[model samples]
Structure formats: C-alpha cells, structure tokens
Target chain A: MSADPQRGPLPAWSLPAGETDRIRIATQWPEEVTREWAWGGATGAGVRVCVLDSGVEADHPLVGGLAGAKVISLSPEGEVVVADDSEGDVVGHGTACAGIIRGLAPKVELWSVRVLGAGATGSGPVLMEGLRWAVDQGFDVVNMSLSTTKSQFAGVLHELADSAYFRRTLLVASAHNMPVESYPWRFSSVISVGSHEEEDPFTFYYNPEPPVEFFARGVNLDVAWRGGGRIRATGNSFATPHMAGICALVLSTHRELIPFQLKSVLYLTATNVGGDR
Target chain B: MSEPGRLQAAVAAGVVGSDEAYRALLQSIVEVARAIFGARASSIFLLDETTDELVFEAVAGEGADTLIGTRIPSSTGIAGWVLVTRQPLVLEDVTQDPRFARDVAERTGYVPQGLMSVPLLHEERALGVLNVLDRPQQARFTLEEMDLLGMFANQAAIALDLLQRARRARALVDHNASGDTAAVARLAETIETLEDERRAAGVRLVQALDDILRGA
Candidate 1:
C-alpha cells in the first residue's frame, strides 16, 4: 500500500539534549524540605485529584464523597457509552484508590473518570479517552492505577501523558503487577510507582534503577471497598494512590511545582533520600 | 510436525483434496511468527480492498479470544499506517510517538508498551499488517528483529495469495471437470472444517507461546 502522498515523514522521536537521563538528583539536600514536608500545612485543599479506573463509590465513608465523578466507557464500536454523571463503582478498585488519597490528603477535591466496569477490564482507547478527559478538565493530579499492554496505542498515550505533564497535570501511574511491560508507566514523563512492602502508607523510596522510579507500600492494607466497607489487597496499583495523595499535598502548598520539580521534591523527601535517613 | 512441514502438509492436502488445507497452512504461518517473537500477543489482518479496512483473520495472544473478527479502519492506527506506508516499525516505547492510534489499542483491551509491526505486501500490493505485542522485559527490539518480522510477513503474504488462487482453481474444477453436486458439497464442507482447524491451531500456538514466555 502506498503512503498518503500528502503526509510527510514524522519527526524523529528524540529527547532534548542533556535530557537523556531525566531523573537526576541534586547533590545537596534542601534544608527546607524536611521529613514533615508532606504534612506541612498543605491538606491538598485546592488541588483536584482524578482517579482513572472503575468508578469510585463516592459515598464510601472513607471517601466521604467525590467532588465530581464521570463515566467514560465506550461502546464496542468505540462510541461513547455514557455522557452523563457516573452510575457508581462496578468493582471496589477505584474506591480503594480514592480512600488512600483522601486519607493522605483530606481536603483535596476528588474526581473519578470511570473507564472500566464490572468486568474490571477496559479497552485501550476508552482509557486513553478518560485520561484525555481528565486532562482537559484541568485536574491537578490524575492517578492511573490501570495501564494498557497493547503497543499499538503507545504513541497516543505517550502524547497524552506528555500533554498532561506540560499542562502541569501530574499523572501518577502504576507498574504492572505481572512484570509484563505496559504504559504510560514506562514513559519517563509520568511518575511511575511500584509496590514495596513498607508498612507506613506515606513511606516511599526512590529507585536507583530506571523505568520503575519509585516504590510505595502496596501490601495488604485496609482500604475502602464498593459497599462502603474495607478490604485488604496488594499490588503496585495500591502503591500509586499513596504517591498521588502525597503529590496532592505537595502541590497544594507549592502550586508552582511542575512534574519535573515535583519529582525532584519527591526524590529529595523520600524515606531513603536526603535528610530522611 | 515442524512448522514449515505443516505448511507443506496443508498445501498438499489442499491441492489434492479440498481448500481447507490451504487455510491451515496460512494459520500456521501466523502461529510461527507469534512463537518466534515471544510476544504477549500477535494478530494477522487481511486488507479489505473495497472498504479500506483491515479485518482480523487470526489472533494469537493474551485476551485475543474475541478479536478474531474485529475490523479496523485502514486509515486509522499503526496497522493502517503500516499498510499505507508499506514500512515496518519497531517501537520500543509506543506511547512516545505521535503516529500511534490510542482508540485501536483501547479496542484490543491492553495497550502494549512495546510493539513491532510490518505490512504484508504481495506483488507490490499491500495485503494487510502483521504485528507482535510486548517482547520480554529488558529485550528491546532492534533493526535485525524488524527485518526478521518483515521476512515473515513476506512469506505469509505470498502463502495467502497462493491460498486464494488455489480456492479459485477449485471453483474452476467444479465448474469444468467435477460436475458432481455431491462432490462439490463435500469440498465445501472440507473447506469449512479446515477453517476451524486453522483457527484452533492459531489460538493453541499463541497459548503455548504465552506459557513459554510467562514461564508458566
């Protein structure tokens, strides 16, 4: 088949010079960012945190209630499945994530962009659309606990992830539990988290390796379920929300922190880094 | 039987008896490509000339059970891009590029972090796309891998063209040498049986590859 006569060759996918290693650390520790930095008067009051997953059960006591929630499912034909407000959680996954974020940053405005349902599986396009919707809504922090393994959609997801980053909307993604490669967690632009056995919910560690950059507590911990109850589950999925919660707290007080700056701040304040030793 | 040997067997069976054997041969090619790649999933789409769509004829990979009959617009997604451009692509980080279509991945269930795709061309005409999903971790796809996939796609395209021509030959035989209604009916039934075998074999190949790659 012949290529479109009008379309030219795409620009080479390259990074800016000196950005080959994106996550570099500052040699000297900032004295102002102490162990209590996350808890330093910022309750994430003005930041908006969007959970992109199965719809969250907003009425769950731990969640109190969502500031706003929307369902973004697509029909088998890729048509919009619903256009109005959300119907509620199909499973308890979103609720658990919401609970974690709410617990860490109590005053953050919570929103849900439901891209999955009872099957607990969603199409790549639907999830992409949900992420795009969250970004368009100008949410401060978008927590993506789920990811697509379809490589065909990678470029678009990367674009959206970068788009969110440039717009100052922090996208927090989880590394796959199966160890199989997936995205946008693999993208250096977004914050990627993995599960660690640390008991403290707020305790997170910066990885020395590339790809999976951070680890947070994702073991069996009590979290809100769909029926307003609690359940214990473990996966990198759970670890992601803890980081998102902390990010909301950080952004609330430091409104000027872009994704790069926020990540640096996180690296500096990590349990194993800087003065937290 | 060895993969190439199966193709020979299918071809022989198709030429001597009915058209079913040809389909088996085509499906085997798809399976062999999946195994060689150690892919999380793989699919073969045939281009629909009239509608400019790529219709899934065989899918072997994780969660691909329901994707056998799915159709994608020929102008959308990377498959379409590959078909139109007649170029092979190996994307280590698929999301970082702009050419990828997110909607197509959404339809497939899981978005692949890494992908390798090539167009199927025969006689300078684009036939469709052959794509493999995520590779084993720490193993990035290289130019050598892209060339290998392109080679596989070439062989598959030629084999498919042969299958179509064989089916046409059978129809001609029915019209001229074999006027027996019962024999013609039996030939049709045989072809149908062969299609089932082909589909089952393709799925089994993918499942086996998945088990092997996952170290299950």
Candidate 2:
C-alpha cells in the first residue's frame, strides 16, 4: 500500500448515508472485477495476511474493519514504545495498498505491520523487526510495499521470508521504484513484485535473472481512503498489493499451498510468457 | 508432455545451450508418452544425415539404446519405412512381418512384439520417428491410439523443424563470425547444444482488415 495521498480520493467512490465526516476510499480496481472477486470465492476469508507498511488511518472508511499497526516493542535503549508515525498515512500510499488487498481478498483476516515512520523511510532494524513480528504472528501473506537501498536490511528481510515461505507464509516485497532494482528486491526468497499499468502489464518483465517475480497494476491507481475519499497511486509499492490480494485469493482456495507452491501456481496460471514474453 | 513442454519452456526461458535443456526435454517426452498413452518405453532418435544413421536424442524405459543410431536403408527397416512412406507404421510382431529386417536386431537389443512409429514430418518432410516400443500391461496400440500419436507427431515435427532451422541459422552466423578449422569443428559439436528458442506468435493480421473470412 505505497501511495502518495496527494492524488485525491479514487473515482466512483460513494459515501454511505449517515456516515458524515468519514474518509471516502474508492477502488482503482474495476467495480465488476472487485465485486466478482469479493463474492466469488474465499475473498481472503479465514486466512490471515499481514500488511507491513506505513500507519493506516484508524478512521479511514476505505479500510473499514481491517486491522493493522506499527510493531510495538522495547527500544534498544529499553524504552517501551510503538513506531512513531508522526504522520500516519498522511501520504496515502499504505492506505491505497490496504484498500486493494481488502477489495481483492475481502474474506481474509488481515494484520497491518506498519514500518515506515514518515516520508517512506524506516530503519533496517524497524523493517526487520516488523517482518519478524508478522512472521511470528503467522500471517498467510505479508505485503511489504516499501523497501530501501540498505543491503544488510534487505538481507534480513529475504532470509526471514525464505524461512517464512517454508513456514507456509508468503512474503511479497517491492522492487525500488527508482527506475532500477536495488536490495530487498534483489533478494532471492522474496517474491519481488514490480509496478505496471493496465496498458502494459505484459511488458514489465520482472528481471529475467533476479528479483521481480510478478507485476500488477500501479499507474494512476485509485485507493479508498478515509472520509469517503480515494487517491491515485504509482510505483512498485502500489503494485505489491495486487500480488498480495492474489496470494490471498489463491491461498483461500488452496489452503495447503505453502509459499513456494503459491509462488509456482501464480507463475504458472499467470499469462504465460511463452508467446507473450 | 514435458519434453515438448520443457522445450517450449526452455525456448520461453531463453536458455540456449547446456545439456540441462536436453535432460528436461527428455523427461518431458517420457512423461507425455506415459500420460497420454500407456507406453512402457519410448525413445526419440535424431537422424544423423552425415552418417546416414539415427542417434538417440532421448530414451526412456528398458533397453534404452534400442533407438540410438540404428541404421538401415532409406526404405528397408521400420524407420526407413516411415522415411519412404512419410506415414506412421505399426508392427504387432516383427518376427512375423516380411518387411522386418533381422540384422538390425543385433545392434538394438529390442525384441519387438508390438511396435508403433510415427514419422516426425514437418512441412511434409520426414524429420524422424516418434516410437513407442511396447504397450503397458499387455495392452497393444489401437488404430485410434495411432491417430492421436499422429497428432502428437504433427505438433512435434513442426516444433522440431523450426528448432533445426533456427539451429542452422545460428551456426551459419557463428561460422562466419569466427573463421578457422577449430571454429568449424567447434561449430559442428556445439550447434545442437546451442539451441535458440523459436518464438510462436499468434496471427495479428486477422484483425488488420475490416473484412472477415468467417462470418461471426
């Protein structure tokens, strides 16, 4: 759920009656498909997925009933504390990804593992600590829509994800949106997801060698927000949710599929690169 | 299924060269034969035009070398029969058949009771034969079974022929790029090992025109 809130509430978002002063979040996903995925299968029901990102607007209408947070832990200095989100979701990137996951996997239980403190920056310790918490908490899927150039931090996330995969939890991380792939995404175990618009989903070949396992819609995407508002999103952060939601959808049907199997199925069922690639 | 599927996969993987693709292709072919038809053993032979003999490209089940470089006249043995007729040939018992040559049995340890061969022809030219040595659990190949085998042959032929042409083109380019006696020897040894996948693109031309060939 990596988005900048400035793009404004997503289109086609309607506020419910008597819900005055509520943030309005809209689906960038086409209504028909969203509605279909919602009604069709598990819709992420009963499955627990983790969203590790910036803080969520507790009062946001678009993410109503879904749960998330910054991992509360004792500081290295032995101080009891929670991640400082001086501006929780003030940018709306985390909110956008959360909305898409909900729209796609409405039935699944979700836990938000907030890591970014402000301006999409978080320490390696904070990010790794967040991942460990999500894994220990046993999430079916963990969507890390934010990553940094920190190689050591990236290694921690990848190793944890590799272990998590064996543990039946899928970990999806973002490739840096800066036009080239950097660490965390460069890590092997992580199912690195990249951003692509609906107009060019097939063209974004996740690096043939390393990182970039899959791609999803990210260009000009709308996400539901608080007070009946939504915002358009761009970049790999925005795209990771699509894969997370898809993981939820698949896990709902194939509860037995471990992370590797889940990754394999997605690669298999996805439009084959045979002729397309 | 995997041989063709994996070949298709490798082509898609853009993994040219290396024996790994060959191993993957062989495993795929065996799996396909067993799954699609209850075959006990199967082997794919490559025609070595320079030696005028068929060499084992892939083999599965018992007596694996039964199809490797087993040579005969162009119109003599069962393989030659396919080359001459450009059609599949079936033999219930090679001993009872008059067309069956006895001398070739010394090279290939296969004592045939039931044999089926589908000519791998692409663009109407014989590439090789796709053969199943024996049926599973005493079952024999039926006419209907052979037809399906024919269909498999048709797809394989087209894919293989395209594969070969691509190989030749690549060899020519490599030959010209590095000229020497050593280069020529290396080229011959490595061209088959250097497989460039042939892309299969669907027709976009149908949508280019307003007129429809078939009414909607």
Candidate 3:
C-alpha cells in the first residue's frame, strides 16, 4: 500500500478478500491522511458540497455564489417537488451554512437543497425527498443541518443515509440542538457534528465519544443571513457545514476516497486523534 | 440512605462541633466521584447566585482541599463554560485546549492532564459543576463515562438544591433559638450585675451601721 519504494508495493491481494483496490491505494498514501486539516492550502476547489437546510439565497455575498440551487416543497395536496432556483431562503439557515462552507473552502462548488420552510420546520416526507434528490445528484458531500424527530421516518432516513454511504457521498449531519433524540444525525453512516466554543473559525475537534463525532466553532459565529447581511448564531446546525467544507477539501485532493476511507482520514486528521498537528 | 437520601441526611445533620455537615457531604461526593471514575481528584462547586460566583464547595485529592472556598466568576474557567452552556465536556489534554484555564489548576496546586466536567443542573438552570480531574490511566473520556457523570451530576444538583433549602429552613429555626439563648444570657448577666450592686449597697449600709455603732 506504500507509494514509496522503501515501504514497497504493499500488495492489493494482502487486503481482506472482499476489499476494493482503493483500500490498497489509501494504505499507500498514509501521508495524505490527517485529522486536523489546514484551511490555508486546501480550497476545496472542485468538490461539490450540497447544503440541505432552509433554502439558500444564491445572491448572498457571504455565499459568494452557488453552482446550482434546488428547493423541495410540499404542494397543497402533500406532494414533494424538487424545483429549480425559483425559491429563495425561507429562514436563512441554509444560507448561513453555505456561508460557513464558503468561508472555510473558498472555491468549492455549492449546491443549495432547501428542505425547511419559513417556520424553520419541514415534514419528514419533504426532508426524505430532498435528501434523496441531493444523493441522486451525486454531490460529493451533503451537509444536512436539519433532522426529523418523528420516529416514523427513521427507517427511510436510515436507508437513504446508507445508500449515500455506499454511493460514496459523505453525509455530514448535525446532532439535535437540544439533548432530545433526532435522526439521521444519529446514524453511524453520517458524520454527526456538535457545537464547540472555539474562537478560531477553522479549528475543530474530534469527539472522543460519538454519535456526535465532531465539534466545530458554532458558538457566537457570524454567518450569512437572508438580507445580504450576517448574524451571529449558535447551534449544531452551523457545525455540520464546517465538517462538510472540510470534507470538500479532503475530497478535493483524495478524490477516489470512499465514505469509509474518508471517515478514517477525518479520524486521523482530528485534533485529538492525530497528535494535534 | 440512598445517595440522595444520605446527602440530605449529611446536610440536615448540620454542623458537628466546628465542622459543617454540608461541607462533609460535598467532600463525600467528591470522594465517591473520584473512586467511581478512577480519577486522581474530584471537586464540587456551587454557584453563589448573589455574587455570580462559583464557590469551590469541597475537594478531594492530593492537595485539592486547599482550593475550598475559592471563588471564581460564574462565567470564567472550564467550570464556568460548563455552567454557562449547560454542557458536559471531556478533554484529553487540558494543556492543549485553549478553553481549559491553567490558572484555576495552578491555584489548586494540581495541573490535570485529562479532565471531565458536567453541569449540576436543576430544571433548566445550572446550579454548579462537578469535575473529575486527571484520569490517571486513560487519555480521554468515553461516552458511557460522560453519561454516567451526567447522571451523577443530576443527583448532585438535586442534593445540593435540597441541602440549600434545608439550610435555609434550619437557619430560620436556629435564628429564633439562638435569639432566645442570647436573651437569656443577657438576663443572667443583668441579674449578676444587680446582685453585685445589691452587695455593694449592703456593704455601704454595714459601713454606715459600723460608723453609727462606733459613735464616729
């Protein structure tokens, strides 16, 4: 698995029988693996990160610009429809997440998939539909800053999360703002994030215990609001995009890395896990 | 008694001689917490709402007792972070983390490498923080352990709440009883002073009688 001749060609056949050849390549490039990512060099240049939240205003200055935007809404008769850029931000939550990602990774392709409505609440069916749309669109990283508390939709969300995982789309989900249970952030297939009070915008920590695997600077962060302005906000919702933006950076370089490999790289790059470099 | 029950008893027992039962209970909590988590030290703090300060109620560990009664602003230190945010934290390297204030540990003469702290919350309001410092063998805290400490923090919050209420109730009763005792002591002193005056009068009368009898 080593690219260097001294470490030699660690044979692909040496891996477990069912493992893919990419595993061998990943093993060869251990130097590329890290938990604490440096934001200075990595621009997340080509990676497509989809922000799934309360719609994004494509013209928001902090957002820079979006590569594409979609809005999922429930019709009067309860039909889920994924529409083009006809919709603007309902509550600015999605715009906030998009701005954070843009701050961290300046050149990444941004996609807005609006799931939450004006009240910052959305039905499970609409959430599922929007997530499905994002996954099917083949975005490299999907940032889900929202979650459904309803138990009825857990199975569907779980399935979609697994599908995204298998299809090499990294799902970064936010843990519930409160202590109460919510999904699909709880799903192991998704990277769960929580808020930390770190002052640095780019700094994040890897949680020793998970279900909430990461913590980013979500407390007192200035994020893009709806009216071409910024507002200081705090929540797990804001933290997910930080991870997603970081994921975009990781995926930009390690383009062939799958979900599992990406998670390993994140673990290795975490502030605590990788010796704080 | 259950833990809460015992904690209530310890507080209700009041001061034995010069030592405070509340202090004893707080120390017991720290000792039990340390033993349970295999931590090098443990400490309990109470939020003094009047002063907006976190008062170190009790401490158990090597030289940590010296930190008792230390007051920190409720918005300062790692303990303050837990109190303000109402979130538990487990840090693997206290020195490396910026949020971990070294000054608090310096004052206690114990610098912990790894620590876990949970807010002692009653209802939605945070009462204080319960800290387990320096996991001697482990580098970081596990979720199961953080959960366990959280549960323990809940119980401690309830216990501390009950103890404060009990103290207030006891203070009212003791205030009346002590007031009466002070009144009785004053009366006794007054009677003694009166008796001394009466004796002096008697002595004066005798002197007059003696002068009369002596035909001065």
The candidates score, on chain A by TM-score, as follows 0.85, 0.72, 0.86
Chain B TM, per prediction: 0.65, 0.62, 0.68
Q: Give per-candidate clash totals.
A: 15, 30, 8
Can you write out model 3's per-residue Cα lDDT over A1-277, one digit (the tens) per residue?
2345788666655664444554545334646544434333778998999988767888989999888888787876777778886566654567888999998889999999876541112346777898999999898999987666556778998999999999999999877434445678889999989877777765778887777888876655667776676654455677788989888888877788899878877777776666356
- Candidate 2 stretches with Cα past 4 Å from truth are A1-40, A72-90, A118-122, A177-181, A199-209, A226-228, A273-277, B1-216
- Candidate 3 lDDT at A106 equals 91
Compose the digit string of candidate 2's lDDT tens values, residues B60-87. 7765545544454332355543443233
Interface RMSD of 1: 17.0
10 residues in a row with least lDDT, candidate 2 chain B = B198-207
In model 1, how large is the Cα lDDT of residue A110? Answer: 97
Q: Model 2 TM-score?
A: 0.43
Cα RMSD (angstroms) for every candidate in the order listed:
17.4, 27.9, 19.9
- Cα DockQ of the candidate 2 complex: 0.01
Kindly list the per-residue Cα lDDT of model 3 for residues B118-181, writing each as its tens digit. 7776753566889888766433334456567877787778767766765654554345455543
Please say which candidate is ahead in DockQ: 2 or 3.
Answer: 3
The alpha-carbon deviation from the true structure for residue A107 of candidate 3, after best TM-score superposition, in angstroms, is 0.9
User: What is the RMSD, in Å, between candidate 3 and the native fold over all Cα?
Assistant: 19.9
**After superposing candidate 1, which stretches have Cα over 4 Å from the reference?**
A1-32, A75-77, A118-122, A275-277, B1-216
- lDDT tens digits by residue: candidate 1, B28-75: 777788788887887788776666567777777764677876876764
